[model samples]
Target: MYTFVLPESSRLQEVSAEVSLEELQSQPLQEMIDQMFAIARGERGDTEKRVMVGLAAPQVGIQKRIIFVDTGVDIDRKNLGHLEVFINPILLKKSSAVVLGREGCFSVDPCLCGIVPRSEIVVVQALDRNGKSHTREFSGMTARIFQHEIDHLEGIRFPDRVGPDGVLHWVKEDEYPEYRKNWQQWKVLCSWSDWCAMKSGKSSV
Candidate 1:
């Protein structure tokens, strides 16, 4: 369904300073969003880096102020079972709670680590990949990823969410399986046993 995707290492387009609807109205926003969904639907590369859950227009070099996210829901493939949808995305409102979480970028390695601070929840308004407008309520990782993508539209990256002294790390994706296996062996993490068994790291559902 798409032909162009921003390379993992490409310099993402910076959101034009003070971009507004006037800018989005003039961009090929719909086409880019369609291409993003096609990439997420696994029509392209085989790596987890490319089949990720979300994207930003800036990442694809269209700096007209837009983003696309597919929270990967409804995947039959276990741990990746996140809701799949796209957001043209404008941050409507946000709660001011600092929720810190691990983040990785397709632009870099799948196994990098950075702490990103985000609202516990958000209310957003945007059009879908179809150009149909809608308002969405998001919380948890879903909210975090969406908010992160929104920042990309504004020329921000996950590391920007880190504090001045925040640290970052990089690990191999192949190692996640062993790490998760050991993590589940002793800790009674919420559904750790089931989730661990279901998630062999094959599908980023």
Candidate 2:
């Protein structure tokens, strides 16, 4: 399965503790980021899904303070790009413009999930694959995914921060799968986009 992006909490088992960019020896963070993009673009696991625009270490079973993203780019059933990143990220700041957004997790169970609250913008610091540090200032969906994956590295899940409007009862969560099983038959699917859609009950892809 498409490199199963959703990792369980304990998947944080033995992470790369080298917070500084220089400490990681494994393919370098930028190379790792490129690998993540490869996984997203269907180069690594072109099994069922044909594209991947984002990925974390745990998605491929690595535990490091890195994720790859193309903040303003979109990859769906149409145009996909190599426009992505190897983010050695730390969320140093955030905006107070709280917005409710639909979200899903590569680590969360059953795959499908709901909307959550997140900062509208963020600034982060991390290194590229070469161990040369780069920082980015991002807003909207890009900021949201950065924070979401960062949380994963620290053993957190999206449902823990869900919005009140999207709260689920056990009964509702159960019902959702059956309804969507039939509904999903006609919808175009993309991990990066559909995860966004899980929150809104519509795909952003």
Candidate 3:
């Protein structure tokens, strides 16, 4: 079984390879998908309390272009809370309007989060688990989640998308409420590059 790859691990920095149809139909790949779903749902023993909204293959020590996302809403704006798998996903388009929102990653320290600017809407093309091709347009939180996971396939983490003026904030799991109430007052951490260097043992914060 594969384990979650941390930011410090070099595997997280490598671009993931595409999954061929033959490999996709293999038992091991199917089992990995099952494991990913379990981890996303916080069903795994090592999973944290916060269920992951999305995850990529590289995040779990697999260098393949696979991602699972929880599209929290349905077409009618109803809460669906279901997971979908995308293999060899590609971003087809992105809206000109950008929105800044707080984001955290499972591969990184859960307490570390920062504001990330993302397109308000995105068009993505990929194959489903069964090898069916899909080209869907996603918006709002769903779009954000899709973009984040796709970035992972390209070896890009959420912190790498943080703007120059943006700073990552470390909030303790127990003090989330207080942090939310006074987020601006929280201690500012280093930039994404600095964090990467520190994690790689190239430098300190």
Candidate 4:
């Protein structure tokens, strides 16, 4: 069974231990990757169930440096791509440009969301499911997903990255009508922080 150490319940605050090159080559590693996908794909929240794109080993109570990237899968009629596994991943490069984007974590309690400033693009190097090393670049939300999962390896969560004044608001299921209505439109350009700010009369934007 796959177990996710959600926010306060898990008390998971330590950085993950790196998986060695030899460990990545082990046959058992495939089973772990499979489980990660199962856990990520099956998780649902109280709100309008968020789409899970990737997850880290630590999220599943494993300390190893393993990440499951959901590249291919159908969620709400959108095909994300093929499922990809990364072992002992490394961030080879990150563009200096940054953008504030909406982000939410399954581990976070009450799971309202917040906005975070993330690199617009990032290049990563890691061992694939076959234990083969590859380098790739990602942009937009896909890049954000990689960065979010990688942050888990370093014991960082999205909320921890929000600016001091940035706000994260909870959206109860009943609020989904309004949330869903606006999300469909604002997500194209506005960050959650900005949305919250506007709602609270903090900013005119």
Candidate 5:
């Protein structure tokens, strides 16, 4: 199983390098891609299984401009689980319109989530796994996923995109009766200091 490089790790903070067509088609690169897919599918890992929609090379300690995203398209035109692989991807354009949505990361604590602002639409050019170059436009959730993964290549994380007024929430595993009754009222109930303490205790455990 592959271990994800978490936040604060130097590997996760370095910009990734572009790859050549020859390198993309190499055996080792193919195996790395396969392993990434397995981790995304929850087919590998000793921890609790959690399926991921997208993954980047840097998240797994490979400093290469590569990412695979499950576009949620159908297999037989009516199903799901279609994945699009991007190699040496470059963001060409972003729409003026933007949206805010909650996001989580595999390299970050699973309980941590934060609202992030992202372009509503984006155009990206990239080489596919087969080394074919193509440009595509993505919008909505798919666009958000692409932007998030691309940021990883630039050594950026979702938390870094959160605006000054934005807040990061650490959700508790146990159910809270008060929170369940009125979630909106409890949005800021958990303090950042409390989360820090919880995280410190978890690491010791």
Candidate 6:
């Protein structure tokens, strides 16, 4: 029964604390996940408009190196969509190739969305929920999601990645497919003032 920590909010800006194996199997970890899911799923009326693919412990006011990824599961308690939990995650390797994708976050500045560049592929190593370690590779949108949550663990936000003029508004597909065709130009003219008024208390989808 807790809410997400907003931008410039209660959460401190620092790398999250590493979770020892003992603490991973205890109640504190379970409680932390509970709060994260509550916010991720909008169960506490604090959810974002966009579908949340993953969430980190720091966003839930817990500065621990823990994160959950949605892999299409049910009844997982804290993060229903959170099919997997990673503890003390470490990036083993990342593809040199990168791509620009429209990215958004639950902890970004109000009323703003941006097209941030992201790695095309990433291989990470971490401890699973059962405290077992595993190495996995992720690509496409899934890779993007993992990177975003990992950034939280390192005290990084989506806005911090925006280019000099990369801020954009959430353009709907049916309404503005043209925006996609004219990517760079659209971002330049995507005026922050226009979206500024649209800022809600939390980040956009």
Best by lDDT: 3
| Runs with alpha carbons beyond 4 Å of true place in candidate 3 | 43-49, 73-80, 178-188, 191-193, 203-205
Per-residue accuracy of model 5 over 1-205 as CA lDDT, tens digit each: 6778755465776799999989989998888888877766663232223346788989988899999877763211133356778999888999999997666677666656667789999999999888999999988777888999999999887767764456676555353333334443447533455434433444421
lDDT for each residue of candidate 1 in 53-80, tens digit (9 for 90 to 100) = 6666555555545555655432212346
Candidate 6, residue 153: how far the Cα is off, in Å: 0.8
Give the alpha carbon lDDT tens digit for every residue of 12-60 in model 4.
Answer: 5678887777776677777787778777767533224455677888877
Q: What is the C-alpha lDDT of each candidate?
A: 0.55, 0.56, 0.78, 0.69, 0.72, 0.67
> Per-residue lDDT tens digits of candidate 3, residues 58-164?
99888999998877744222344778899999989999999977677877776787778999999999998888899999998889999999999888888888855
Candidates' TM-scores?
0.65, 0.63, 0.85, 0.78, 0.79, 0.73
What is the total number of backbone clashes in candidate 5? 1
Q: What lDDT is reached at residue 151 by model 5? A: 94
Q: Evaluate model 3: give its TM-score.
A: 0.85
Encode model 6's per-residue lDDT on 124-147: one tens digit a residue.
899976789999998777677788
Ranking by lDDT: 3, 5, 4, 6, 2, 1
Worst 10 residues of 1 by lDDT: 186-195
Model 3's alpha-carbon lDDT is 0.78
Off by over 4 Å in 1: 1-13, 16-30, 43-51, 72-77, 81-88, 178-205
lDDT for 9 (candidate 1): 24
Question: In candidate 3, which residue pairs clash?
Answer: none
RMSD of 1: 9.6
What is the number of residue pairs that collide in model 1? 7
> Which residue pairs collide in model 4, if any?
71-80, 71-81, 71-82, 72-81, 72-82
Q: In model 5, which residue pairs have backbone atoms overlapping below 3 Å?
A: 74-79
96 Cα displacement, candidate 3 (Å): 1.1
Q: Best by TM-score, which number? A: 3
Clashing pairs in 6: none
